[model samples]
Target: MKGLLFCVGLIMNCLFSTVSFAQTQNVSQQDALANTQKQLQINRYKYSTKAPKAIDGNSDFNSMDITSHGGDLAKLLGDNIYKVDSLVVRGTVDDVDFHTLWDASFNGKLSVINMENAEVKNGIIPEDAFWHSEQLNIEDGYITLIHLRRIILPNGIKRIEDAAFSYVVNLEDVNIPSELQYIGPSAFEQCENLKTDPLVFPEGFEKLDEAVFANCTNLTGKVVLPSTIKEIGEAAFWRAKISSINFPEGLEKIGDGAFYGCRLEEVHIPNSCKDLGIFAFKLNKELKEMHLPDGIERIPNNFADCCINLSHVNIPSSVKSIGKEAFQSCWCLNDVELPLGLESIDKDAFQSCYAFGQLVFPATLNFLGEECCTYLTGVKRIYSMASEPPACEVSTLNIGDTPFGGYDSPSTPNDIPVYVPVGAAEKYRKAWGWDYFTNFIETDDFPTAIHNININKPNAQNKVYDLNGSKVANPQKGQIYIINGKKRIFIN
Candidate 1:
């Protein structure tokens, strides 16, 4: 009887212990759940209380200030996601959060995004992070657009990948981070309303990718580039409204159409620049003057084409060839001294330059392209320093279609005299393109007065006369003349 009673007591004790253990486990789980709920409520309150009130007291329009630790923001915001017009994101965020924000912007609900206090994952804004496409109509097709008006990038971001913020038409204010090192191609292209004045890049920034700021028509004022930049990619600042820009010293190359169609008034290329692509500064109607540094070997095609107001340019001696249409259609270009070492002038290099004075070709010149100097109606004389006439293409069989055809009226015979080296007039008369000219004057003391000049004495009483003995009304620089009956050069 005693043994049976002991067994029953032991069984009862085991059952009671099992029940107690189950109750403790349930209580722990319940406590954890309650704490989680409490924390969520606190976070919700934090967001709601700090969020800015809607403008003009419109309750329908709302701005939210949210702190995201990471992951999809849509899930964190819950149903309040649709009401955001402006957002201030803080704490940690990732690409998933950016995708949600992009959707909100595309719906025309979000306008301003400020993430200055946020920390992006990997310190990089990934490629097309906020890019989205929408189909508007059958005829219009798919297009990318966004309604973001202002964006303050996080301070820790180091790189922004290609097309990250492209086609953000309403974006006007952007606070670029100081830690930014690289911005990929077309990152901000077509952001027409972006008015960031005095656009300044960070100190360590290395390059500007292709079409980075292209078509930003309202981006005016001075542009400050960093010294560490090496290359400016193609069409980087095309069609911008910038008035002035300083090219840093370490810059090595300027890609094609880099500054094309801009409103730059003057440009001073640095000596460190060695390569220039076609149309580098073309179509700038407001450009009045430019200075090309010494290391550039060739002036790329259409370098300054159609610059109507360009009156002065100093071509360095390092230039070997002037590319096709390099300075074509510059109506106001009147003062240019071709360097002595220049070897080639490509097709239509200086065509339609109406205001050009006398042209002096260097002895190193070997080839002249078709119509290279056509339509220079104002030029009175051309001094060919080469004893051997440079090779030129005869455009047509008729002499009237020569490079110097438009210098004289079509009704009258071609009378523009070409001055050649001593005993070289006969050589020029037999040359293919030079034979088109009817008159050639030979001179023994041709270019000596141009190179050797004594300007040390005061020219208060000295009278200058041209080689033709015509009294000069205005004596221009780099011209050979008989000053006080002595052959001398005058340059000011």
Candidate 2:
């Protein structure tokens, strides 16, 4: 009986031990699950407050201690797994010191990152924190600063705030999200090394604030602007290496100095642009031709100023006035047809334009400001198409400097004749500015002829032609010419 009782006791003891072991295992798992739930609750509560939407898009969340517990909790939940909040990627995955899996994996790739549905709990990644990374993928996070080679922005991103990626030199490939509506001032300015094949903006894009891409020297090639854009802010592309751009139809205003000092060769100014700002296309020497929109009543000051290579410009009939220095220093401009309704030519309007050979004054012109044509040395004659000379005021020197370009030196007289209607000679000879010219001649009829003839054709026997290729049998004094294929010009 004692032996039997001892065996029963041993068996009972084993049963109790086994039962206790099972109970302990169950309790441990439950405790782990509770801990995981608690961790998740903590994480959610931590990041929910500083979210972009909750804060009205104020991206200043760098002080929060953001951490992820999703990965650890997934393991605890068994096959019904939850996504891991791969926290703070700082070092290689091989390093044991790094607490999170994301940090390990992110650091392992050195410069390439691929995070799926990740939220950056921290307000922003501080400027230049990842200078070594060549590419990045954090679509669902706010990024204020980084040093990356290529960027694939998230689809949920709406607005690129002020100077968000300014001066990110290595950034080459950029995927601007479709939802982006506004790009703040200086967003990508001074990024001298950034290069892209063609920068295409998304559909909802509305505004390009001041200096957005200013001083990006390496940003060459064409830009495809969308029709949804309404305004381009001041100095937007100042000093960029852009070669050409086509403004979309819906564009309303171009801010001042928007394209100053660029290498633009072709520009398509849409008629929708009613308010073209001053100095907008200044210092663009490569621009060869341009046509202003018809609705503009006055040419803005410094319009196309200093574009040395500009040869042809078609000003619409709607223009009533030419502003000061509007086409100053356009050295290669050979011809411009002014409208009959043009009322005024402001001071220095066509100063230093050396290639214009002649000018036809309009009938509606009432004011010709001083120094309007100060240095047009190539002009040989001036025609007052209007029977009456335009009204003008005397300069500070008391001498009317209206058509001042023809004067080379005081000793070398300005002999370029000013032609007027046969009966209007007396009226012009006494006019305030017109009387200043030394040679004023009366014409019976209008001389509306341009000299562009093929000299290759068998030289017309006994037919005299001027140096400008005009048939002039009665050669004028002090003008260079070809008398039947011979360089014999009279000095009077």
Best by lDDT: 1
Per-residue CA lDDT of model 1 for 1-492, tens digit only, reads 111112222433421122221123234323422332221111111100123334345548677898898885888666556567889999888888888887777753678898999999988887666554331222323344566789999879999887677667678978678989998877887677889988888899989987788878899877888998898887788778888888989899887678878899999889999878777788899999899989787887778998989988878888889977799899888746788789999777888888776788888999987777877877777789999999986444344455554334431124667888888999999987777678899975544323456763325697777765687867777655678776576775
Write down the TM-score of every candidate: 0.79, 0.62
- All models: lDDT? 0.73, 0.58
Clashing pairs in 1: none
lDDT of 2 by residue, 37-115 (tens): 2211111111111112112334232221122343342233222111211223211121112123222222221122332
For model 1, state the Cα shift of residue 423 in Å.
Answer: 0.8
Q: State candidate 1's TM-score.
A: 0.79
Prediction 2 global C-alpha lDDT: 0.58
Candidate 1 accuracy as lDDT: 0.73
Model 1, runs deviating above 4 Å: 1-59, 135-138, 141-144, 396-400, 406-414, 447-459, 462-492
